[model samples]
Target: MTSPAPTLLRPDGSNLRVLVVDDEQMLTDLLSMALRMEGWDVKTAGSGFEALQTAREFAPDAMVLDIMMPDLDGMAVLQRLRQSGDDVPVLFLTAKDAVTDRVAGLTAGGDDYVTKPFSLEEVVARLRGLMRRAGTAHAAGAEPILRVADLSLNEDSHEVERAGTEIELTATEFELLRYLMRNQRRVVSKAQILDRVWNYDFGGRSSVVELYISYLRKKIDAGHEPLIHTVRGVGYMIKAPQ
Candidate 1:
């Protein structure tokens, strides 16, 4: 299925800020050109450290990060960003088409992925998709907070807490957790999770979900009783301590 068009707005009042992180100067320039044509403020970083610095200064509404980079990879960069409580939406650019790579990127907090050698049009389209999903142009006001068991999520603040302790989640992890919390006790299948959370049905490859679950476990379930459970051969579920 085709992705939805981004809710593009003028670069005034609520103009979207985007950060493009890539090693390819030509591709980065092209992306910047296309995004600027759409009236977005864009920044470019050729390395992970530079990307982090740019992110701090630019505070982008969304980020386009390359998976393969020197010093620190996209996944590591994403982890650091999340750890710093930045929920900026991330779209990964990967050179490898391996499922493991895709799953790793998604689990590490990427909102989306576009394989390398992609069309500029497709990249712009996907960026818009991320922005739309992030509610950047819409719902700019306060949103309600939600909770299930010890986990709490503030939609307005984009902050998550577990057992009264603050937990940092990437845009993708937050979305995934929100989906689970929305369904609560319901057993959500991997297919369903991929469709709703990733906005793509990744067929039967549930490793993405599994990988994200591991990430969540490290953050939310570590040093405590497990709240998220795998339902062998079926799917996953989140529940209160029984």
Candidate 2:
């Protein structure tokens, strides 16, 4: 049999949080999408200052940093982070291909570096290596599964099951379920669901949250003792029926 896929997660058994810092919005969006597809929590910053601020608040396990920016380049950002004793693993993305630039980045505490016009697959693979090497993240074996009562979710394969039967989910639905499953038994607000499941540019509209929750309920809760619960004036949670 083919070996099962692997999942990279924080040592605490949670999704790995990653920071993607770049002056280019397009680049940041691309990287953010690639990382999130790996089931990682990703935050993007358009400048070094924003990156530092997000780092403080997000405490990401790894950072994909750009070396060139009009405001506070990656080297300066890394210096500042090191000064603050952040020690977060950084992967430098730059157009600079000079040997000296690579050495300088590594000397400045970057854990890895990739040239511009790079492959997303390669970037993801490199980040996997960097995060694992930094000891802040690790692969959760051949088959990484999340279980709650009779429902099971596979982070690696994007497969979900309920009571031993396979269930299908759209990309958005899968992410919603993953977020709910990740924080099983804990209420998560619609705002949280909107931010985490969809792209961050949802404009604070949460009606989609209710629509998707209904979609999930029809699939995940129909004909079974409800596992997903709603808290009036609050949000939603998934738990085992006692």
Which candidate ranks first by TM-score, i.e. highest?
A: 1
Residue 195 of candidate 1: its Cα lDDT? 73
Candidate 1 residue-wise lDDT, 1-242, digit = tens: 98544347523446689999999899899999999987788999999999999999999999999978987888889999999999998999979888788888888888788887788877776677577558564333424477877788875457888888999888778878877887878899989888777765576778998999899889989988888888888888888887
Query: Candidate 2's residue-wise lDDT over 1-242, tens digit each?
Result: 97633788876789999999998898889888988999999999999999999999999999999999889999999999999999898889999987788889988888777888899987887787666545566567534588889999876567799999999987568778877997999999998886555423245678899999999999999999999999989999999989
Give the best candidate by lDDT.
2
User: What shift in Å separates residue 150 of candidate 1 from its native position after superposition?
Assistant: 32
**Residue runs of model 2 more than 4 Å from their true location after superposition:** 1-5, 141-242
Q: Model 1 misses residue 177 by how many Å?
A: 17
